[model samples]
Target chain A: MRELLRVSAPVDLGAIDPRSTPGLPEATAGEHRKGWAREQVALLGAGLGRRQEMLYATAKAAQERPGPADRPAGRVLLVLQAMDCGGKDGTIKRVAGAMNPLGLHIRSFGPPTPEELRHDFLWRVRRALPPPGYVGIFNRSHYEDVLVARVASLVPEAVWRARYDEINDFERELTDAGVTLVKVLLHISYAEQGARLLERLDDPRKHWKYNPSDIDARARWDDYQAAYAEALSRCATDAAPWFVVPADRKWYRDWAVAHLLKETFDTLALGYPAANFDLGRERERLRAGEAGAGGTGEMNGR
Target chain B: MRELLRVSAPVDLGAIDPRSTPGLPEATAGEHRKGWAREQVALLGAGLGRRQEMLYATAKAAQERPGPADRPAGRVLLVLQAMDCGGKDGTIKRVAGAMNPLGLHIRSFGPPTPEELRHDFLWRVRRALPPPGYVGIFNRSHYEDVLVARVASLVPEAVWRARYDEINDFERELTDAGVTLVKVLLHISYAEQGARLLERLDDPRKHWKYNPSDIDARARWDDYQAAYAEALSRCATDAAPWFVVPADRKWYRDWAVAHLLKETFDTLALGYPAANFDLGRERERLRAGEAGAGGTGEMNGR
Candidate 1:
């Protein structure tokens, strides 16, 4: 049996330098691997753009043939987390925005309800898990209990520490159950965040989305950064590693997210199930006053 | 001022004939008009499919490009009514499924929350309207308090009767604010509804969607039909005419909805705004340690 204790650990936030990270191996690890990482990112970016165009085309085709069982099954789940102005909504609008509705599902989880707060943190999250052949996304997920709550002193340090392990276990369970989780942490600098917040306040229409409390949150920016570093360090398991994306530039953010989502879906091995419709057999069955009496298996054909 | 007392007599449920009557026009309307209606239906079917494809594409493109002002500022609102098996969800998925997330917002209202119940019915609805450059879809919206509640004797007769005028005025407000409302009623046969309900019961995964209370409502199906006819007849205004779609066949349902959505978006004439980039000016600005921002205006140069 797999050892659960060994799998979970508290994330070490303070020690990680964004410059020196797991993505680029140490000098002793060899230049080949480093070159490979860069190549992978480049190749993933190209495949993602191609897949995006194909996805739009496929959705258009599906519109013509409204209900077809032959649609590609299996989907991608993209998880995004960020500080107040982190581009979660913008990310969704671009990457998965054009996905075929039948194949892709985007779910946003705000603050949990009273009933949800009573259960284990993961309960509400598990309920939103996509069914087979669908992609489900969580905007700000169970991670909030550990990251934001801990940083803001909303929860005790011990309570937040205990959750890193819980998150690891939960993610492992999802991966084992055929769900690919791409966790993205949009890392915008304090200066960039200030510009974004000002933009929101400056615009009258966006006033609805701004909260006065966000200012208080901004004051504790360093604490949140420390929390993110810790959570990412601990939870970046082999199964679902976190990507610290530099998000100062909106163009780069789009490119990075598109790369991440494209990579996740490309690995899902989704395709139409293999089956044959024997027209002759269908015609013969129809002739015997059994036109609509095809077995339940026929239902699955669609 | 519009005449408030000019309401047509309510449709008599007992007089409904599936073979004729409301399914087709009265004899007084003439054969040439009938032929025209048939041709429009066919053209609408084909045009709808094409338009649905374009809507998704346009929305996706808009979402990808970030405006300098950060607001494209346009929207489409699609509304429908309530019934256990009402085709709202299906219609939304089929018609507006692949729309760009940036340009699409779908709001589904349940029995109102305490906050919503306190206000007029349109309060919750208007709050849920899409921002500029987006499409807002309402699944079983504000009309419920009027249509179903009126038919089921759930509300006072006077209160429900007043709603017809209220809805027309409310839709006019949306249209004036640059929001286009496309309303559709999926007219299904009693037998078809029975088949769908049975399918839901037989499928374990769909069991949550099955409510025992639906059977009680289905039993009073004729009353619901009469309520729908009465509601549609009154509120089908020139600004936003109600389309009574023959929805026994899902294929035709998709076709009709696609046509309606396509026509609306096509009318908007949306495309990329002009590229106001001055390469020479930008070159000077770059050398002067400043980037001259692209001011917002008629970006029609594209």
Candidate 2:
């Protein structure tokens, strides 16, 4: 993980001020650190399991409360980029797998629809944002405008360069609206990505998930990384920071994302609103034919 | 709602022993009874909003936690009859929309996929059953084999007649293995359904959601209802009872379903699991490292 980060954000690593974390020790490199990271991850996985069950229970409880503002409206958005078969699908399936349906939504951004192309680049993405009290997961988000478009030169350099500021401002607005934007760029080594792409070609059911154009994109890895670094440095804000996840290790990536999302939601302090109801009174009115007595003769079509 | 139920589940209503529910005092006419039912429905909606939010939250939390005995590990099966605007798409979006990405899945039962055409009728539906801890929302599930297939004479009488028992046994096995099966017969009146069909024709974006064949199907509403009534009567069990929801009003339908799902999850008894490492021990370890190791990692890939 540190190696990937070093390559992706070398400057930021040197410049950022230091702070302290409880569970994690200093970022180190060695066999011992690897072993320790594995053990901690296993323990974290167990906590994740328990946490998931509780989430389901809590969602069930929250349903009994009233609508709109009665529940916490905050959401988490996960953004990723990868070569074909770089574990993007697997990560989303596993990490976001157990979330409650009522509170979580996943949108896989494909080529823009006709409506999206007519407007500015960010319009379609904004439409996909989760409402308050929900979590929105974007498979490949607005970053595509920069990463894919830049690597392929689909848009001219000037057009793509201007997008860095537009993208950053878009993210800043979302964060200010209470969306905890945690961007993860899945950094799969080119070798691992190639092997997976070959695996996709070999499988019939998965063949549809692959596109030949992705191979052309993979050829320009170094160039894309430079584009990525430029965008991350400019866009990483206090509210939304980019995490370059090492996708060569699937287990590690899943663990890190689940851990990160759990931390974010924990900070929100979401729960059911205070309960207050008098069912008996409502029942009495029903028996006496008091409620709905004089409103309307019957339910109109409206 | 009761009138819709009276139509959807003719025998279920008649079998409801009057001794169970306290009947309202004598009214001037059945008009008053209709008024009373409307009021009861209003109250039910109020209670359902909070319940929906909590269910969503619980599912989100569950996504982070490790698998539990009760978490969905079994396959999900969907069954539905063929009808245009029969609440299939809306139901699919609403239910699947709220679930975690990991355990929540959906399979729309379109005309059989090429692979399905080679097998028996039930083969396709059986394959789509959700794995455990996963929620599967079937848009027009297997019931179509017995309902529309019977009503439209799409298959031989013998073929369709035998399917009812086959479906019942299939559901029994799924429930035995911890699969929570939900069956909803969205009962829309002929008048109400006509308005919906007309609206679909009027809306351009919704054009893709409409099918011209629906007009011919609507012409046979009574035949479809009779098929539904018979199939539900034989198949509805204690473990999985058909929810005869009034579909004329979309809000009420959403409310009823959200309520039903809440009741199901609440029955699961999902709660916080026992902690592995002592909280105090973990906290101590965290606080111990707070001074030496806590720092923001490098902001990497775009």
Top candidate by DockQ:
1
TM-score of chain A of each: 0.71, 0.72
Residue-level lDDT tens digits of model 2 in A83-105: 56667777765565434343456
Best by the lDDT measure = 1
Query: What is candidate 2's TM-score for chain A?
Result: 0.72
True contacts kept of each: 0.11, 0.09
Candidate 2 docking DockQ: 0.06
The ten-residue window of minimal lDDT in model 1 chain A covers A1-10
Instruction: After the best TM-score superposition of candidate 2, give how far the Cα of residue A53 lies from its true spot, in angstroms.
Output: 10
Report the C-alpha lDDT of model 1 over B168-207, residue by residue, as the tens digit. 9998887876677777666666655556666655554344
